[model samples]
Target: MSRDLFRQAAKERQTLFNAWLMLNNPLALELAGEAGWDCVTLDQQHGAGGNETLLACLTAAKAAGLPAIVRVANNDPGLVGRALDAGAQGIMCPLINNVEEAEAFVRAVKYPPRGLRSWGPYRAKIGYSGDYFTEANDFTIACPQVETKGALDQLDEILSLEGVDMVCFGPNDLSVALTGRLDIWAKEVQEAMTEVLKKAREKSVMTLIFCNDADFAKPRIEEGWDIVAVGTDAGWLSSAAEATRAAVSPGS
Candidate 1:
């Protein structure tokens, strides 16, 4: 965890923490890394700003010795390609529903021969590696998310996509897809998530869970989910702010 930036070295298991820097705060991202997280995913989907912010966040991750991953806005090959070129060690594509979509997602993250991502290893990734393009592809991780009812149904096939290194479960979106609820611990949503983990184990792929608490992460970890991201940077800040408000306001 301390040594490797990307958690790619682990074949059977690993734990990655999400930076979820929705506010594009580099200090928050640095704090997450310093707190001993394996890696941080820059939440591009449902996040503010654009590539400029992403570049700064990636720089912070590198400086902290934590690999930075980008959860891309969509499954757009061009966007995915640019994110990688910007020096993101990992790329997470959201709402992947089936093998075809998974295939396309993989294609966007990987370079030619393995994919059609076009050549741009000369970017941040290489710069950090001391101009080492010889083994750049091996270090890049491509994560395609399984977040909808449709995607859950095709979990096995989605996991089968070649260049995809991990499957991150978007619990909030998945809950809406399952029972139309966004609450963190919705029952139907939990059941659906368990099933997704079970199938992910069967396919021999790494699993990343999105949860707000360590308690919520237990079942997923027991189910062999490789990495669990507790919450977003925004949520952490909001929770802290609320706790401070309660402590100072009319307490018993």
Candidate 2:
């Protein structure tokens, strides 16, 4: 479980409260950590900015004692390797379908012998502790998000992979993929997501759920998800502002 952040959280703490960061700002990242979140997952796919922002936030995460994770849009080796080199403790790539994709994604995060990732920890060495090269192979986490129907089809094989540390279920994308519409609460999507949890449990793998808010996340965490990155920094900020404005404005 130590090698798997989600599992570690599930075992030590019931479930990890993660801030899904859509903003590239370091201050926001620091505040999330200060808010007592177990970790932060920087959203590179739908989030703003690029590699530069990732490096900056990863540094901030280190100072805040919050382990940083990056959610890549696709399974690109360069992106995966770069995130690791920049000191991300975990890498969550979306739309990973089948064993080959899972295997390739894992290889990009792992080092020599175990994987093909080049030897480079420009920020990892400084942010992470004690001989990174030796410990990285075991310390880094590989979490592939199961979103599409294709991924759901190959869930078992993906879970059984040697390098997969955890499995993340993306309800937003899966909702559309499963029902041809965006409704995370749709019966079809819910059933598919439930199947993912069931299979992961059977394989002894940890699971994470990408949720929009606490209400959505609560059920998943209770249903066996180890961690839930509920809502992005942008969503939280905007929602708070709207709520405050509504309370101050005239209402009956």
Candidate 3:
């Protein structure tokens, strides 16, 4: 299998950057991949696409030589297996509340004693690398999102689990779980984030976080996050449109 560039960067403590794809357009993903994002994640959890679109997006990423990660809508093993078989380089499962959930998420992405993923690398083999089954277990990445109060409570245990390559912080969901509001900067949320980052470092697990843009992510990188996902393709489109409108308008 091809080396997991993101994982390599994380090991070296380098700040790997990723682009978010919430839209179902393959062309947009292809463009984003070509634009040089270290990785591009397809947000199936909250995004508009399904299995078919995910396969297309993965194909597009491969064509641009970019690694593709899929944020699965749930922790279902079949769904996770399908994404891997379809050529996704990584799987990000959301709302993992404890070590058991984290273990299940890891099992779904890995093969054999390491995991329960059924054997089948259809497009993954042809598109990604050779000796698919042999090297896939080591090449694929499994990231469980730390987005709930329960997860934050057991952050260390979750990060210390075997086969878990990294953990992502979903500030929006975390804020809601803590204060019943979507304030990413809430004191409780920030504290939980700090704790997770510190524990991940102690355990030698990689850290990832979703930020609104580079500006929002800059400080977090300094705080020790290995990978940071910037703005979504949808957000970028809207921002560009708004900027163009402002530039052409003469008077308010």
Candidate 4:
């Protein structure tokens, strides 16, 4: 199987830098890869992206030799399986409220015995894994989001699931879960985040942190976050647009 960049990074205990692409733009995926992000996610949940768009993004990521991670809308096994068949190297399912949900995410991403991930990787893993059926199961990474009070309480059990390879902390959703806000640094939100990180660390599982600013990423890295995605494709383009507009505005 082709070496999954994200998995190798996690296995090596290397910090991974991910860039979110909510635009569903293949070019943007390619651009992010070219710009040196370790991996990229096709943010389907809020990305106005569906299966077709995600497939294109996956192809772009593959062309760039970067792993394409798709953030699905919910903990649906069917969606997860389809994404894997569509060539996504990894999957990030959101709103996983408990260990059962976490396990379901695993069932969706992994093969039988591990979990019933119906036999259909299509041809996505053919060239990548050499033997689509056997090798594909071993290499695909399953990441579930821990973003609720229920998830927080069951963090340990969730981490104990063998099929779950990584847990991504959704700061926005976590903050909402804790205090009904999306502020990442809010006191309550920060506490919840620390708890998740602590639990993941204790279980020896990798964790992903989302940062809005480049500067804010350092502290999370120091705190031992295994994966840190610094904002989204839309955020990057919007920031650049605002800057350009400001430069040509009356203030200049």
Candidate 5:
């Protein structure tokens, strides 16, 4: 296949830097891909787009020689298969609260024997090796978000499931679940995240965290997170616009 750099990075124990796309803009996705990000993920869950937009963005990312991933709206196997068939190299499922959900998410990405994904690699075969079908199971990454109090409680079980390659933390939702607030740095949230990180490492499962910036992610990286999404395209664009406005209208 196309080398599966994300998986390779995980295997080599490297911290992969990823970009999040929420604006449904192909040009923005292409720019982010070319800007040296290890991977770019389309946010289908909370982002303003759907399958059509995701496909276009995936194409843009591939043109820039970047691996594209999709965070499906939910843990539905059908949604997972569609993303894979549309050429996504990885899938991130939201609110995975138990081992069953985790297993189902993994099964949807992999083919039978290893999973229950129906055979359909329409766009997935173009740039990949001739043996795409036979090798796709290994190349595809399946990550489930541990974002709620219930998911946190079952973190160990979820990570232990076969075919679950990585576990990503959604701090915003987790913070609310833990403290009824949005402070990701709250003591309770941090403690829970620390436990999750420790358990993931113990099981050899790759870990991912969403950070607002590099500074926010540095400590987590040092804490052994395998991947960190720096920020969303929408957030960056908005921030730049605000900075420009501030510079021009200092007193306003």
Candidate 6:
């Protein structure tokens, strides 16, 4: 199948479940793929994932029949190109706070006439079939994150830009941007997020969000997010470990 599976799913109004791959362990990656996650985001922004590890994980994802998107640490063209070249079906750029940043993000993801991304897909081509050059534009997801008050300020213009298939919301920073804390459930945060969801829907732009668990994720899916990505594998492992330890600890 082509990478457009995710694209088609979004267009059909399906609420896709995306797992956040934080750990670089191949076993963990394979397990996540087998666990029935529709797709995954290789977290290079905050997690320990780097270029080499991301490449391996992408390859593993292909083997598992999973489509993947890489959340780059920053919105640099080189970072974007390398991730795509390494076979990430898409790229989720962070800190997209304006028209220029949004434009640049798309520019690096598409080919000429659409954008200026150079040609190179040695690693990506191994697993993909057909025309990588032409089809890549349509299949590859270009999700620019809508976080920060600055981004929210120009949300309309950013959302209206070409090549922006979806807008990923980062509630942690958005919560801080709206309120002065990291609470994703704050009234201001909800209002802003709801507004974004509404506007994005009206513009025919898909929406994705980052949440800590199913409790938070389910609501956003109900709120009409095209995709809702939940906790990282490492974070889940940590939480489960702590819970298990606390449950059997003498402090009970």
Worst 10 residues of 5 by lDDT: 1-10
lDDT values, one for every candidate: 0.75, 0.84, 0.86, 0.83, 0.86, 0.86
Off-target runs (Cα >4 Å) in candidate 6 are 1-3, 247-252
Worst 10 residues of 1 by lDDT: 1-10
Q: Identify the superior model by lDDT, candidate 3 or candidate 6.
A: 3
Please give the clash total of every predicted structure, in order: 0, 0, 0, 1, 0, 0
Q: lDDT per residue, candidate 4, 1-252, as tens digits?
A: 677666677677788889888898988888888898988878889987788887788888778887778898888888888888988878899888888888878988888778788886774865664776787667788888887888888988989999777888887888778887777889987787888888877887778887888877888988878889998989999999999999999969
lDDT, candidate 2, 117-161, per-residue tens: 999788787735467887887788899989988888888889998
Off by over 4 Å in 4: none
Identify the superior model by TM-score, candidate 5 or candidate 6.
5
| Clash list (residue pairs), candidate 6 | none
Cα lDDT tens digits, model 1, 119-204, are 77545554453433545456677888878877888877777777767788888888788777787588877777777677766776
Instruction: Give TM-scores for every candidate, taking all chains together and pairing residue i with residue i.
Output: 0.88, 0.93, 0.95, 0.94, 0.95, 0.94
- Between prediction 2 and prediction 3, which has the larger lDDT? 3
lDDT for predicted candidate 6 compared with the true structure: 0.86
Cα lDDT tens digits, model 6, 133-174, are 888887777899988888999999998998988899999998
Q: Give the Cα-based TM-score of candidate 1 against the true structure.
A: 0.88
What TM-score, to 2 decimals, does candidate 6 have? Answer: 0.94
Candidate 4: pairs in clash: 1-129
Error of 2 at 196 (Å): 1.3
What range of 10 consecutive residues in model 2 has the weakest lDDT sum?
A: 1-10
The per-residue C-alpha lDDT of model 5 at residue 121 equals 83
Tens digits of lDDT, candidate 5, 1-252: 667777678778898888898996889987886788888888999898777888898888878887877999998888999989989988999988777778888889889898999998899888786598888888888999999888888887888888887888999899988899999899988898899888988898888899978778999888768889988999999999999999899586
